[model samples]
Target: MKVDSVTEKAVKAVLDKFAESYARRDLKSAMSLIAPDDDVVIYGTGADEKRVGQEAIKTQFERDWAQIEDPGLEYNWISISAAGNVAWVAIDAVLKAKVDGQNLKFQSRITMVLEKRGDRWLIVQGHFSFPDQSQFFD
Candidate 1:
């Protein structure tokens, strides 16, 4: 299948929904966008934050979000590409939050892979990480 405007739009909508869900910390909506398979994987910024299933992902989100206060995301850039029934989105943004009574901000990059299942696109894999400053500083 060739990529088309409709497919691109639908896939982009999924990314928008994911961002909305994150803003609200809506687990149900977030889970809805994830593929219902044990193979689903999501990697967070933390070294130990690799979650390899829907349940584990949910747990990690809950744990991570609990400490954040007034969470917000500022998007500096985003790109979406789709081919056939698969889409991949790349995002660059700054995440701001008040964790432990201290303000925290970091620039992070996110990449999400989605697959069209029947009529809806669901995330199969995702990764969120901060840029490694070693190369620039060294």
Candidate 2:
């Protein structure tokens, strides 16, 4: 189904808010964008990094925030599609921060699935990873 301009704008706003919250290290604001359901999932850039459920996600974020300082995030929105109450967003993002006294940077492709709850959109699943090149040589 074709996504209308209003749906696109609303989803974009939510995504932008999430990035802004993360850059500012405002955990509460960041978490507010995520669904509180037990089925919510988040996959980090690491090969095996996955967090399930709101509690697990919160714990992982706390640990990550403890090691990161002065965060900076840039999100290049690729696309957004919505069907009924669900929306998917794709973005290319760069994150930079000071971690353990060292500067760290990551460039990743991100996908987020959001479900409309009442009048607000809440992220239900999020995945972040570097572009995979394995398919090119296959």
Candidate 3:
């Protein structure tokens, strides 16, 4: 796949908006970035976070925002590629938040597939995971 600057910029904008939703805890805005179809799916890091459709994804976002405080992310790096109207992105990030009155940070990895519909690029499939830092892997 070719890495088109124009397409990459558009995809990056959508990804940025998604991260902003985490910070602002705005479910409506987040949902707007996702495709409004049943095919939309997101496999989150949680063991039970395989969400499909808009309602399921919305519930997951709400649960996460309610559980964490001062949510933010350090977008370390991103790789984007596009073909036609479809774009894919892989990102390395650090999640920062306050949980149970304790400040915490965790490394996160995100991959998403977006489809350009009209003038907007909407996320149609996404998978989010925290890298396993187990000694066994080392």
Best candidate per lDDT, number?
Answer: 3
Candidate 1 per-residue C-alpha lDDT over 1-138 given as tens digits, one digit per residue, 9 for 90 to 100: 445788777886887787778878888998999999999999999989999999999998798789798676777887888777788888998888888889888999999899999999999999999998776853
Tens-place lDDT per residue, model 2, 4-33, is 999998998998898888888788998999
lDDT of each: 0.86, 0.86, 0.92
Q: Which residue pairs collide in model 2, if any?
A: none
Which scores greater on TM-score, model 2 or model 3? 3
Kindly indicate the candidate among 1 and 3 with the higher TM-score.
3
The deviation in Å at residue 134 for candidate 2 is 9.2
Stretches of candidate 1 exceeding 4 Å from the true structure: 1-3
Error of 1 at 29 (Å): 0.9
Model 3 C-alpha lDDT per residue in residues 1-138, reported as the tens digit of each score: 977888888898998998898789988899999999997999988999999999999999888888899999778999898889999989999999999999999999999999999999999999999998884553
Instruction: Tell me how far the alpha carbon of residue 89 in candidate 2 is from the true structure, in angstroms, after superposition.
Output: 0.9
TM-score of each: 0.89, 0.87, 0.95
Model 2, position 67: C-alpha lDDT score: 69
Total clashing pairs for each candidate: 0, 0, 0
